[model samples]
Target chain A: MNRLACLVVVIGMALPAFAQDARKSGFDYMGPDTQAMQKDDLANPGMLSVLEGETLWNTPTGKAQKSCAACHGDATQSMKGVAARYPAMDDKTQSAIDLAGRIIQCRVERQEAPAPQREGRELLSLSAFVGRQSRDMPISPPQDAKLAATRAQGAALYSARMGQLNFSCAQCHDDNAGGHLGAAPIPQAHPNGYPLYRLEWQSLGSLQRRFRNCMSGMRAEPFAAGSTEAIALEAFLMERAAGMKLETPAVRP
Target chain B: MWRLLGLLAVLVSFDASAQTLVPYRIENGAITQSLTGVKGDAAKGRAIVVERQKGLCLLCHSGPFPEERFQGDLAPSLAGTGSRMSEGEIRLRMVDSTKVNEKTIMPPYYRSEGLERVAANYKAKTLLNAQEIEDVIAFLVSLKDDTQK
Candidate 1:
């Protein structure tokens, strides 16, 4: 009887890990008109930023005169599936960093260039270009004991109620995903379709920009782009978005 | 001359006294102690029900205001709340509807006893002031089955 009970407890503990399958990207939640727009590379507005990034990939700059192509060789092969695996835990720093943070790191250390600002156009282009390489790839940020704590903090931040509205991100994205806020539909907000174009902004932007906008919507003060809070939130969102396809430069309303 | 000096004193104290709030308690969707002189204008109430930046009622509750498009459907419609619930019931719900249902999405407009991650500047502040709650209650109660009558 004790052996049977122990087996039951062990199975119960492992059930959660096996229970979940790949979640649908916010892409699946978009209306037909938007879906059609995202499916086509030419019609998609985000491709423009991808093109800008392609330019940056080849153009040499900084003291090393090292373009992305110089070290990585070709983005089509080198950067494939790279974006999907970040905000990954940096082995050296023992902390998580998003794709944009990684791009800045390479520029400052490898290329000997000035550190680009978080919201700058150059960074957006580079991120979009890198993201485009991983288009349709599944998001699967590396996981383990070391990264778990930061990701947990990110998850807490997502559920924590903030501002005068007292709305947690879960209240909308988790509870009300695919629901309407007025005429507009709120997507589940998996970060798959990021470094994308937004009609509201009329240009390419990083995920940090969207985070700031959401903070404003909640009437909470937004953390700075590279701030621990922002990074933790990104790490959390990416973990939650595991299995969703990357749609970098996705256009949003 | 004395009246002029007294008026000056009153003006000086106005800034410090502006944030004072009248307290109330909720129990089972009703105000435990009814507020006296709680006169609310139907006109002001209508404004609060429809405004997004202030009351945010239309964000969750569909109301009878056709002028405002795209009202939410999360909560009970306020189109005919006046004909259904008593004025006292409505007042309590606005004060703190959690007394009736703890998981209600409807935010307490007049109570601030428990909330999380409120901005530093907005601590102890309710989403709507006391007068606004009364005004909203008045607006809700005005929507009677008057057309049939």
Candidate 2:
């Protein structure tokens, strides 16, 4: 009986590890057979936004008369591993560019098309489709010297004080984490679950929106959208949450 | 001249008292408290939860009452919290919830007494005054529904 009990205990201990390995091997983290059973929302006819992006991707505009399809080919193949390495720095521009910014660049310079407005459905759909390509791939960013420096700059920004309230992001996200600030337990502010659907915002938003919200919370003037500062901050956050699995389109409070 | 001086003194004292009653502000715009109050009405409490300009409690917590949309799923529900705690305990949590859990994201509705420096505009006030604290407490305690699981 003693031996049997010990064997049961050992099996119980190993259960979590087996479960983890199963998850690593493409099993759904939430439950087995769930992903297979789930319908693809993107494929739904209601996903007109994606259809619009597909059209825009193929359409030609501007002086160059080039379409995104001319250079990138089919999105599923070319966009693989793309979203995992966003908010990258461009040496020539001496600035950081998110996936949206990169798409805008392709539209303007490569295709000679008008830059799509930030936060527009064109950009969101394109980004969403691209991000979905790397759904199962682990996030990996190049760790070259320049990228490292940019990540460090973002780290500094994360801890720096701003606004009239004089609170740093670290204060709420780090120092006072897990505690309720009213009715909400402060989440770790991990970037693993980004491009999320926030109940408060009532729409999908990038990590940049959360950063802006933090600034507002601190009563600081928010940096402009697509600013290098916001990009660098994104780099820092993505790096900080390096090992965590990506949960894009996660629902948030 | 003496009568005028006495009247001025009375007016100054009244102003000082009013300032004392004002809430304390953190360097952030959030208000702090010392103790949660007990004078709140359930309706007012509900308003505070959903108020975009005030508590915004629905931003993080789901409660038994489901009428409000956009309830957060991350934090624990507060539907039966009144049963778990006394009114005084609830007040304490409201005033300075950080005292219960240091890592809590919840801001102190009171107890900004030891804050080193606050914004100039908010220096005279606490996050929530004693009355506001009581009001919130009253509201939370009223959430008790014996049939609630």
Candidate 3:
């Protein structure tokens, strides 16, 4: 009777680990060298953009000639833990907006500057700067009824097979993670890192840029930057990576 | 009439180059006929399977290749594939595994239609040509020994 009871207890203890989807940060999958680079601000190339962003934050531009600092004042204080909670619901549009989208909006609406092109240096710099403020903080996606519906849509997109290859994001990143595709290892694809520097790109990029690269590789029609599809996926990723530490302005191979 | 015939010829040639799938029937979950109506070179097939940018078979399957430093565990091992499945069965899978199992992760190598959101450059382009499919089938058929793994 005691043996059976112990056996039941053992099985009960084992079930949760197997049942729960264990989330891992993308940083866990990278090599020691890459991890070291990300750890040190001086060694990380993405930091240069952060530096540029700091300068841009304080400098006045556009017709109104108001800098981001003029309103927010001291990004380290105002922006801390901010990037961790995006893609947030924009009050005016009632649509999900990622960190980069928020910056572009601020540029256009608040500063009265011309909207910067997507993935351009100015945008990337500001994004990296804002994102860096939330480094090491856990991802905390907003909770709202509308946002939940959007998240559900994002989850559907994540699992839907598309392209000539007929692959979903879940297939490679979820089912085949930690396995090699040729010489490259497939990471769990948590979006904790943004405005990250990729060795292949040799420049800083946003999460949406990474999405397009994967879609193109799958021979799928790549989604445009700031598209509904892009925002939805970003929302889903942020939620999926909930509690994982942010590593914005990260370096990746 | 000659100009009309010439235009027709140009259109036919363009269509042929754009699409490379050869018609083959699926019966009882197998394609009994070879895609090219000719046997393929096992050596060439082996080369294609191992090439990182080509077959990409090792991405989701471990196989008998000893030299490959890494092989995936996402799907079944390719070892003993010949003893496990016939040439026709292998051909059907290579052509389109989704027909056999709707949830299959294997990409359709010989299919070009009914795919969603295909990039402009990849539209009407199959992952492998008819001859290439035969080559892969030939290589898979050679692996009859389960112990080779």
Candidate structures ordered by TM-score, highest first: 3, 1, 2
Best by TM-score: 3
Better of 1 and 2 by TM-score: 1
Worst 10 residues of 3 chain B by lDDT: B5-14
TM-score of chain A of each: 0.88, 0.76, 0.94
Q: Per-residue lDDT for A1-253 in model 3, tens only?
A: 6999999999999999999868876777789998899889899999999999999999999989999999999999999999999998998998888778888898999999999889999999999999999999998887767798778888998998878888999989988888776567888989988989998898899899999999987889988999999989989988999988999988888
Global lDDT scores for all candidate models: 0.78, 0.62, 0.86
Candidate 1 vs candidate 2: which has greater lDDT? 1
Best prediction by lDDT: 3
Docking quality band of candidate 3, CAPRI definitions: acceptable
Q: Write out the backbone clash pairs for model 1.
A: A196-A249
TM-score of chain A of 2: 0.76
Candidate 3 Cα misplacement greater than 4 A, ranges: A1-10, A15-21, B1-20, B66-71
Candidate closest to the true structure, highest DockQ: 3
Task: Give candidate 1 regions above 4 Å deviation.
Answer: A1-22, B1-18, B32-36, B111-114, B119-124, B145-149
lDDT per residue as tens, model 1, A20-90:
75366667766788788878988898898889889999999899998989999989999999998888778
RMSD of each: 8.6, 10.0, 7.4
